[model samples]
Target: MFRVLGALTGTGGPAKLDQEEQSEKILSQAHDFEVALQAMDYVLDDHPGKGLQLLEGSGAKPKNEEDQCVRVLARGVIEFLEATLGFEASVMKKAAATLSEAQQLSAKRRQQFQKMGLKTSSLYPPGTEYAVTFAEACLLHALLMLFSESMVESAKALFKLRKAYHMLREILNDINAAKKKKGSAMYAQGNNESFASFVSADSSTFKSVDIPYSLSTEEQQNKELMELAENVYNMRKKRLEGAHIGNSPAIERLRTDLGIQALKDLPKKKEAKKPVTLSKAEIDKDQATIDEFIHSGVNLCFGILQVVLSLIPPAIGAVLSVVGFHGSREEGLRLVWRSTKDRNIHGGIGLLGLLFYYDGPFQFTDVDFDVPATSDGLKKTSSNDLDNSTLLHPGKMLEDALLQARALFPNSALWLLQEARMLSSRGRLQEAVDLMDSIDVSGIEMKQVRALMIFDRAMTLVHLHEFERAAEDLLSLLDINEWSHALYTYFAGCCYLENYRMCQMGLMEYSRIDFFKERATTLIFDAPNMLSRKKFMSKNLPLDRFMLRKVEQFKKFQSQLQLQDPLDAIGVSPVHELTYFYNGYNRMTEDCLKLSHKLLTEYHNPTIDAKEPNQELVKNLLTSLTSRRLGKVQEGCDMLDKNVLPQIITLQPDGKVKYIKKTEDPWAYPTALYERALFTWKLKGLDGLEECKMWLTRAQDYADDYELSARIGMKIKAAIDRLEG
Candidate 1:
């Protein structure tokens, strides 16, 4: 660390200078590329929705690495520079015209791609961060190549320009030395005549790279090994240069050679050598498995210790502490950090510490602990503090707990389940699942225990918006054969939402919907009081309002789901979830109006009051409803279209809108589609009207429901009728 740090700070040896300069050349090339790309990006930005949109005709094809590099390297940098440079009116006009045309052109890509029935987002590997990197790297290569040749070639001219260029060259010298010392692959492969590049703006790239090695044939190995070695050497060389570390010939040579002199030193086994060979992937998996066991053991042990220490005798705890049974002061601190994780280690550690020390004692007893039934072992967690210096470290804490618990109960699922919950809370979802998978919940209603785990996991999935998985888990839980209206209703509502989304996304399955809805209704009607007596506030906030709204929505949707032939027909309702939402909206409005009306007389309209806040939105929706009730559908709709919709887009579910009031827009959320449909109905050349179905599809980005589908379907029918007439 010191050597690397010193070299970086200019205290490195002269030999390191060459490697450092080479790295500097690379870095300089990257900067130049940035400046250049920034310019192009500015041009692109000026024309917002424009550019290389020719999709079906031809995808973006930067034939070689250089072209790809330059394209990406010169992206946002120049654009940002231009933003600072005062854009003129003419420039703005030109940009607008260009972007307008670009947008029009770009639509074709989406159109053709959609017709083929594939996800555009999935065209690139989901969440891959490749495109930006490779492009920049390519550009860096080109820029450095250009600069290096230019510097060595233009060394004389640069000497005349100023001392700044010389200083830059010297800095590059130092950087190059460091890169060579470390043995960069890029540097080894990089021609002294050329520079470097790789700048891409696209989030992902799927370019295939040659695997670099094949031990299948000795002949193939001989040929590929050299290339692979070169690649490795180049990367090492560049890494050293970038860090400004002093160049070391020995290091470079060492990188080039094997432990022994001859090729015999290299392992003879191929990837799957029957006797001993292991692939990198296999090795990684083995290591991970080992780590999992260690983590699990440590956690369980710590949990046992925490419980045991809590019950320790004061004198013994103090004597043990002084005698270093736990660890030295530093060791203790470090162990505390490792132990604070969800080790399910609670009860005794801090209490023991407090008992031992008369002075201010450790506050382990103050730490929050939960004893829960789960698939993983028990978990005792620390709050959000990352240091783990607190009682939350799971390592020792969990280790202690397991030790103590096993002594008392031998083997208990109840304790292990708590462990699983702890793992889930710490973002170790898969780990928690694995831990649960190892459990045997037999004889003691293990199915229900497993079901609970499924529920917890489903909750997490829901948070991540993995609705499909969450729905599946929830359904599994319902299938367990469960009871209670509130529980089943909630699951039913969630299931319906999932199905609605699936249906909207071109899914034609009806049986799935029927099954979920049936389950939901059965659970919902099991107890009438389930809907009324439940307290909505989950964690302090009176969520009763929101929960009620959700329940009301589902109930309404269920009521509207009157099938013509319950036994023979498809049970999927056209607007089940939507019916619920609309129903919920009505219920919430009813409550809101009551509050608003009371305020209208006493508080003279809505004012800022935390306790009894304003209900302007409710009042407005009421007014709209009144107008609609008084035979003003068209008028109310217009008011909703022009006024309410935009505001609702920003309205909080629980918090009322401060500036806007009311629900004049009966079809507020679907206004975008409604207008598009209406425009088509009027024979107006609405923007993207031909792609109305696509617009509807985009609307289902978050979730789906029968209400929206019905509205859209109705609009389509109305437009068809008007067009035919």
Candidate 2:
């Protein structure tokens, strides 16, 4: 009995360790677990430095595999946070290295368990928890690899993702198998154990089962998983074999058939007949923690992967299907929702993921407007209603989750940020700004979160037409982080330009007009030069690329019109023009829309050149979009058809329109098509679905290399999907 308890406790022998030492070891393990949890709590509460310090202060050497895994994972998470927030290559490299070390630790632990003759298929296998850790480390490492400037690294990341995916699937299979075998003798014995025995059992009375040790024959299975991973990797490699960098999609899909083949080809290994088993008390005590941790971790990692992969544009999604990978957004959301029900670190992250999706990407792509229900039982056409009816509405779920998170971590500013985002989405911009301002991020160690809060507030301020304040907030980001200096500079410049225009129209104080104009000119010209200084994966960020294009066009317009003042060449407020990418029009208040329309119409480059049709097209596009948001669907449609479309298309003798492509304003034609589609949908509802799809399809063709083309593509795909649904 003494031998069994000692073995279970990893002491090797009762004679080698005294009773006091045994108790101290168990207590120390518990303490380490608590410390890890506390560290995570600090991070979620926005005190990342405290979190890191707490983790590092807790003994540098881990006492056990679990402790080692927890410490490495916690530290790696901090590194990941810093890397993603700062977008620094060096930080990402460090994160990858830390996660790689975790993977190695997990592998070593797995080998130790295998040598102990533990069956991989057994419920709550001694070291199966390491598999969960391994998968998680692999997934995180793969994600960090994506930040690399090398395509080879990206390709390697894809292979790593496949391996992690399969590893997770295997763990899920083990869990399902355990559920099926719950009534077996081994399982029943573990279940029948008393909690009291677990806490108070005398080491002398415990007995070790005499199980024969044998080598595991799982090498073939590992090879099979690797082969499956290789197949998907090769498919992507073939597709991108000769493509220029950044030309082809970085990731290709794994075919569904290949996925099915993987499952079929990798048959489950036979379970060991004489598996070593811990006593019932020990099993019951440890199983609860193990189950919770493993289950939540799997759900969190797999759920995020699904959600991210599912976000691929349908055009890209279809192409991805040809190669092999597919993700269901609905299933992904469901899994993430499940993970949020736990109290673990996974649950906290799951909550953040849901909030970000509901407030950020979901808002950006979903274009449904609110429609009042009719007494006659007419169908409502709002996208929000559609999502609600389909059980995809996260409103109530998110509210409940936020409540739980706030209750658990009362000091967390992250939740407050999410709440503010909710307010902003509901058109309560000032309240959102106020809520954001109330959070004192001045002392927060995570500069990324601080930057995010500041950026969010600035954007909300822009929506409120507080241009001067918004400019100040944007410029302030430069001091906090170096993620994107060009983006900050360009946006600050646009804000100043907006302020100058407001002053010109007497909407703002006229005394600072010259100061605003001069600052705007200097910042705008300086923005293009800053681009070469910052890059992501060796390419200009999408927003930076868009800014560069806009600056070039602005200069060309100035040259053509022979304008001396750079401000005079601006036909539309560049800030307002860029807001389209953010789906800002959808969130605009009626009065704000009116103000925007007025400003867009009021600004004119005095000398109109017939040769430069882009300036007029830009004005019309902004006006038409604002008009649509203002509930003038037909008016918006007419503006696009009569005013904007005519300038970009020529009626051929065969009665087919040939697009008159302009290199300068390539974005105008496609964006106009997309706007026209939305207007059609609003006016015609279900009747106009086909027409909306046609227009959306045409928009895709015209979007090549256009500014914010990726964003436009996502909107186009989302609209088409909604129309089809």
Candidate 3:
């Protein structure tokens, strides 16, 4: 592929790279590639063992969903690729059959011309004339539409090897350009907040200063390093026979062609391809890593993808890196997967692995997930409470955050958590949960903040209807040493209460509801702001009125300025506010279809800019939202696609989507289950009616569960009608 790219360069490629050899640069490039090769260097690296035991001494485990996601992704990629290739593990035999049939035909190697396909044989008479055509080549490009994926083995390696080099160059260029424009833009010392972090700030050091010469030199060096990697990679690409299982040679070539010497002193050349400038918005949305991976996968640069993708499973990481398959990843993976031996083979299995696991890398855990900021945010005034708001920071802290969230690195967990919540809400729960779970929470000092984390989980689970499982989340949490966070106590109480309620609902018994309510009152007193929250609320539970009552109560609470835990206090609140804004926009689309109007007045959300919630729900949301949106009625059902139903439950990890976070988050459990249920309800048809009847009783396990009732109610009714029929 490197060679092909080199050939394409055609006298106008890689100028800076044409320059000198420095031992320092060579060592750096080698170090980078070694890291890039972790996923692909299976030859040198031992297979990572599975299970908690292996991870006992290994720090944190990959987590259930992350591990499952990779395996699933490997499987899915294989399936799609096989289907596209018109073969599975045994397609070679079929192709061979055609070759044999071509030999037996006497009409100059033609096989029944009009009915069958292809024209190739050595048995026809020498002078015999048979029409030859290249018609199929047209579709070969289209063939790339199938079986290609970022998860393909080849796709991954190319990505890591090339992408890392590309990103470094890009970052260096940006730094250099920033320095040239602003002056004194170097990273060394004093910039860090902690004095200790300075590691002894030296007056002569490069810290707290930026120099153009140093910046430009850094970019110049990076440019050369990346080009070198691209060149060597392309060199091996030109020799590819086809995309399937046989594309192993190029990987070996990638490993061998670019040695330490080649990286040392390479020649300068012309522009490889004119660089395209993009806006900040565009860059933020671009999944360059994913795009490259897909490209490698489809180009039969399978050896490349295999290596890069090995760093992280494509199923879980593809979306994070690229964004989507149809536009970018599909072509890339298809180019390689379709060209492969078969899906059933090791290669095929690898491809399928790409498909199923890319989105998840997360799984269902016994926990509660909630977002109190959601309820709180709903109560804020129209004057934009995020600005100059003390609910979060004190004095100058608010000022600093305002300057940061809008910038590149916010250094705020709220921002990260908000991102996590949005992903979970979209139904990539596993990914969201994985990210939240992995977050470093030591920086958090507020007890209320800790509770909010628990709330995030409780809400996710409530939506999922994992009644007993959701309730169990509070047990361990309540028993923990640091269970003092107000948000934590509230959510844990909610989870237990909701779980018991769900059990009652499931059993259709009024007694359990009463018992759980009694249990809930006892736990509420333990909440951080329990007395304040219940000061004057109605005696009747809010769940009775659904989301409406909760919305009204929060609104009242906000109006009085009687709130203890400010809405924006957690740092992540503003980000959560953004999510609320988007949901408001999505609601309008829901209004168009009249999906949910049971809440208060028909409020139009200004955030979505009045755009439709799109033609369809996102893949992450599809499975989770389907049952509630589609319903069992035939007329209402016409809006659904049969194939989509199965696809929804197909179980994608957060690893499949572009905007997803790289680590685990606590809010994903319910989100994943909700989506799984969407798929399940649609496929179950008549059986869902039973599940619907018990939804409300089960929803009561949580303190602020008004929203859960609505979600479950919608799905249950729709499910019962569809499945029970």
Model 2 Cα shift for residue 581 (angstroms): 2.4
TM-score: which candidate is best?
A: 2
State the C-alpha lDDT per candidate: 0.31, 0.63, 0.29
**Estimated TM-score for each candidate:** 0.24, 0.76, 0.24
Q: Candidate 2 residues 195-238, lDDT tens each?
A: 11222123223211111111123411334322332332232232
TM-score of 3: 0.24
Worst 10 residues of 3 by lDDT: 206-215
Per-residue accuracy of model 3 over 493-543 as CA lDDT, tens digit each? 454454443444353356566665555544433453432332111222222
User: Per-residue alpha-carbon lDDT of model 1 for 114-142, expressed as tens digits?
Assistant: 33322111112111112222222222222
Q: After superposition, which runs of candidate 1 have C-alpha atoms over 4 Å from their true positions? A: 1-410, 426-431, 440-454, 460-485, 507-546, 553-725
Better of 1 and 2 by lDDT: 2
Report the number of the highest-lDDT candidate: 2
